[model samples]
Target chain A: MLKGKSILEPMDMTTAELEEIFDLADEIIANPPRFAHACDGKLLATLFYEPSTRTRFSFEAAMLRLGGQVIGFSEPNSSSVAKGESIADTIRTIACYADIAVMRHPKEGAPRVAANSTDMPVINAGDGGHQHPTQTLTDLLTIRRRKGGFENLTVGLCGDLKFGRTVHSLIKALSRYAGVKFVLISPEELRVPDYVRRGVLEANNIPFREVKKMQEVLPELDVLYMTRVQRERFFNEDDYIRLKDRYILDAEKMQLANENMMVLHPLPRVNEIAVEVDSDPRALYFEQAKNGMFVRMALIMKLLGIEVE
Target chain B: MIVNSIERGIVIDHITAGTGNRILDYLKIDTKKNTIAFIMNATSKKHGRKDLIKIENVTDVDLTVLGLLDPNATVNIIENGKIVKKINLELPKTVTNVIKCKNPRCVTSVERNAPHIFHLMDAQTREYRCEYCDEIVSMKNE
Candidate 1:
């Protein structure tokens, strides 16, 4: 049923559909070679209009692992986009060559435009801090794999919650599950947007509390998701410098956290998590990145309607 | 005062008395260039207080925003002193280049080159959303 569907936003996929993808990902993880030739003749077109080495490589690796070929540009300067081609024209032309497409553009709704232009499935890698549904999926899969299920878990989200697109997507996605509470850890200036708080959390009647310090809620969290507070997002450099050190998760802070609490980050991290924390068994960012490939592979296969033997 | 007859023009009727200026401000209508007549605080059977703007040389006006701002505004185009075309302005399907989206981070708010685009998602509710930021702008909020 997910075949020919476009994954543009986190809300685009229902709870049931997300569970199905998770199931597929679990199957793929348990038996990797089973889906090796599932997409043998298929081609995945990765149209990254922005510079994203991590996301582009993840999509390519997902396709290659599934026995599919990858083709497309990482930056718009190298493609016909430099020649003033519209997103519609580029997607339409690429659809002729590729069976599916994954795009990352600086413009919000660019992937939606691409999806509207072509019949092929268009996956939104990231759209100008608007939405990143796959990263949400990666987080969900990581949580499910680590914690066994999503129910009755206290998840703590820290760092730049205001401009963090992944944090927004994760909150929306996780709110659909049962008995999940949120501990929003961020500065007052970087609180989650009102629409998200109203539309997703409050509308769903999900319980959440906002706090500035992560250490206060550290021991209570089953999952701790951290994001980098970029210097660009802050208006004052001094404030960024002052607050940056407090938000960093060193081993001392990790000692105060729950023993079973899993630490996850949507990398490329910029010193938010200490290197010592990476050695902890609770640190799952590396595994989180690997899960991105498997989850995307499940998504690509399911969207393309390729039945695995 | 003096009643002026027009052979051909448009007559906007039933506008709330004090809102006539706001309607003009919204439309950016130039009274200096056009032969325009505005009667303020006029008595009406339906409305206790009303205003009317009659334009002698103009037949068509942009009714999209007018309807959004004031749905009760009625437009009557006259030809040879007889009403030829009558239209009751209604909310448009899509609105562009009008009220600014208040969200500072919205692309439409910061980008001068981009036209402010809004769509009337809930007509009965009278809710409009910025096409770029998806922020709902309500008449009550204005």
Candidate 2:
């Protein structure tokens, strides 16, 4: 039933649907080669309107590792988009050539528009500070694997809550589980947007607290999800500089955390997480990166309706 | 004080003072056929100061849309110069094509022909969010 299903946002799939994907992902994780040819004849088109080497490659790798082929542009300039071709026109063209499309656009809801225009399944890679459902899948998969379950965990989402699409998606996904307390650690200006507060947290009646410092809330979190404080997301240089160094996760800070508490970051991080912390046993970002590929593979199979052994 | 009354039309009353002209423009009132009277800064006991628009020979004004423009507004149906019916405005549930989605990432933003639909998230707060991207359509300044 998941065949030709487009994933524009995290909530595009129900909790049961998400659990189905996770279940398949667990099977794929246990034995990689058994599902290698699951999508043998399928083709994945990566229409990256923006340059994203990590996300594009992960998707391409996911498709390739599943014995499928990859095609499409890394940036808009190389494609007909540079010639002023509309998203509708571009995606309609891609649908004829590919079975599924993974699109990353600078504009929010670009993939949703593309999904509407095409019968081919469309997967949103990342839209402009919008939903990145695949990354949420990766985060969920990582959390499930490391922590054993989604319930009763204190998830600390630190830094750039205002602009980090990953944090927003993760918060939304985590809020769905029972007894998941959210510890929003960020600067005042970068606090979680009111829409998320109203729709996801308040609407769900999930208990959450906003804190300015990580130290005060570090020990309580079961999952400390760190995020880069990007300079581009800031309108003022002084505010960015002031808040950038405030949330750095170093060994000294990690020492304050519980030993069992796993640290996660939606990788390609800046100085928010120090290099020394990568060597720590609790840092799960690199492994989390690898998990992105596996989760994406499971997602592709699910969307294509390909049965895995 | 006898004001020009419509024989059969709509009397939009209790608009926040100084907003009569904007409502006229927003509603795209057809001035070619219907005779319209715009009363700005009119004294009202309920609202203290209000604006009113009385359109002659027009009775098909969209009440749901009028509610969005001015929630405190009341529409009085005039039949043979007597007020036949009165309506109190309430915020609409889903609004289409009135306001464009502000989020550049919103599907409606790029797909111009796409319906600019907004779901009323909090009716009490008059808050709406985009159906496509869930970006809260902040009412401030809009």
Global lDDT of each model?
A: 0.84, 0.86
In candidate 2, stretches whose alpha carbon ends up further than 4 angstroms from where it belongs are A236-238, B1-11, B25-45, B48-61, B76-88, B100-116, B132-134, B137-142
Predict model 2's lDDT versus the native. Answer: 0.86
- For candidate 1, lDDT tens digit of each residue in A207-289? 99999988889999999999987665566899888767558899999999978999999988889899999999999999999
Full-model lDDT, candidate 1 = 0.84
lDDT of 1 at A110: 69
TM-score top scorer: 2
TM-score of chain B of 1: 0.87
**Candidate 1 clashes between residue pairs 3 or more apart in a chain or in different chains:** none
lDDT of 2 by residue, A68-183 (tens): 99999997888888887889889999899999999988777788778988899999998877678899999999998988889999899998898888888888888878899999
| Model 2 error, position B105 (Å) | 7.0
Please count the clashing residue pairs in each candidate, in the order shown. Answer: 0, 2
Lowest summed lDDT window (length 10), candidate 2 chain A: A227-236
